[model samples]
Target: MKKKLAATAIGAAMVLSMGTGVLAGANLQEIKAYLNGSITVKYNGSPVQLQDEQGAVVLPITYDGNTYLPVRSIAKTLNVAVNYDGATNTVLLGEQAEGVALAKDFKNSSYHTKDPNLTTYGGKDYKEVYFDNAKSSRSSSFMLYPKGKYQKLVLQVAATGNDIESFYVQDSKKDIKLKTTTIAIQDGLKTIEVDIAGVEELFVHADIKEDGGMFVPLTTSYFK
Candidate 1:
């Protein structure tokens, strides 16, 4: 991404004190901030191009040994909605929806696929899921922090090359198992839905009977 100077230095101040502290009152003030063109932002191993409202390239600002970037630009780039509430001085990123999140969208996952490729089954496009860890343990899992906002969980598991025994959902925070379902390749793809209302930390795991390149392909995983 190209690095260009902001239209004014206050641009940095606006971002530096967005929701809390100085800028919450929306009073005009002058503050010294430095524009460091050398700083580069990479999201998920890919370089991000930061820009401003007028399509001008924007660089990160350094203030009191802290660096700040344009949140609107970055969030929108990642396909997340961004909104500014001037009355409350609040910045909202993303919206509430029945489909709260996708499996590939979660960053706090363990022993699971990182870069999922588009795979098709049953005339539907699905993201292929594979275990990063070996098959000896016969399981892989991901962590989700819903913070009691969502009420439902839905996901599909399919076996492309081998049979999957089961997958389960759990509230890791409270050490409670929500639900579990068995997956049989002969039965085709299986959809597992569970009630997750008031769940804080959700744990989803898949148990495979055998290991293969396409052992457990998750067609869809989302929370409602």
Candidate 2:
């Protein structure tokens, strides 16, 4: 998986900009140890240990001289909810249900879209695959060469008001199928790619019904 530090940091900044109060102070070493799996941090002032999916301590983070942790993970472990606002760069830690409301508020107030037709990959016109609620359902036809012939398959998506849950590409003759898991839509552009085996005609489907009201523009490209 890709390290989400840039996106996470942007979200954090938005939260702070919204006047969300920051924790006055925390021990850098303690936070570091906790994230590194060297130490377990228990909320409620308890002594229980927690671990990441791998049983390793999800190491604390230090970026540009500032210490940080996975806000969602830490909040959950501490029995709190985490909320982030990409537009304002702010975060809120509290109960889960309340966090949803906060997130909805941010979405409603910060939602905006710019023209996505200008995006491209490897000089290929990407707007050919773009779609929005206005067009609700559409199909994109493309060809994918064998893996050695192309370096990668790139998809650029920009959406607001809805999230892209899954995308699919299929080759009917060869029985090749590819699909993406749920991906959250942030305020700007997001790029996703996959490695291909060879050249083939592919039916590409990008699904974005999660929030129903949004539009998504998709561009497909092959890299050398």
Candidate 3:
């Protein structure tokens, strides 16, 4: 409805960042074409949700024991570059694309605990990185390697209003605050925000574990 399929042009290391909608709306006719499934499709070992132009989530179709996926959605998920020749009904999907993409890596603090069983959404397991509240520990470090100039980085953060205050993005000599909560990339969830305007390499740190008792989980965060 409101989101259309977009791609992150990254070289060598392929990173597929699909969370929420970035556009306002999609073509009405095209939207109806993709809403024809109820199964999740996994590309390169990660689950991907298909959506219509209206932002309503859709699914991959399974017919005759074979699963069919949205061509654009699948390509974006696996960092595969796709091109279509409408006249000949031909589609070309290529691995990776332009620009060097960044991967998410984490450094745990003393009190930032990680558990594989901590992340579950819509009855689906998301083996995301979960961090426990740190008391005597500092914020864990999040490393990002961006290729060129860019603006805005969206992240999925599960924390209350108070805890979010402890989060900040360290870009160059500036420590910028990530603001607000947005729609989750997963079907139904919420996330914290980040500002990555013109950032190359940066550090994402959340020192909220000092409050204790609470835990926060981070899902796949990407820059567009």
Which candidate has the highest lDDT of all?
Answer: 1
Model 3 score (lDDT) = 0.44
> Candidate 3's residue-wise lDDT over 1-224, tens digit each?
23233322111111122333422232223222232344445444555665543446656553444445555555444444454434444454442233222224444444333455555544655455554544454445555654223344555555532344455566644455435332222323444445454345676665544443223344455454
Give lDDT: candidate 3, residue 30.
28
lDDT of 2 by residue, 73-134 (tens): 55445433345544544454432122111111111112222334433323544343333444
- How close is every model to the real structure, measured as TM-score? 0.47, 0.33, 0.37
lDDT of each: 0.59, 0.40, 0.44
Show how many residue pairs clash in every candidate, following the order shown.
0, 24, 12
Ranking according to TM-score, highest score first:
1, 3, 2
Which candidate leads the pack in TM-score? Answer: 1
- Cα distance off (Å), candidate 1, residue 113: 4.4
lDDT of 1: 0.59
Model 2 is weakest, by summed lDDT over 10 consecutive residues, at 99-108
- Candidate 2: list runs displaced more than 4 Å: 1-129, 135-148, 210-220
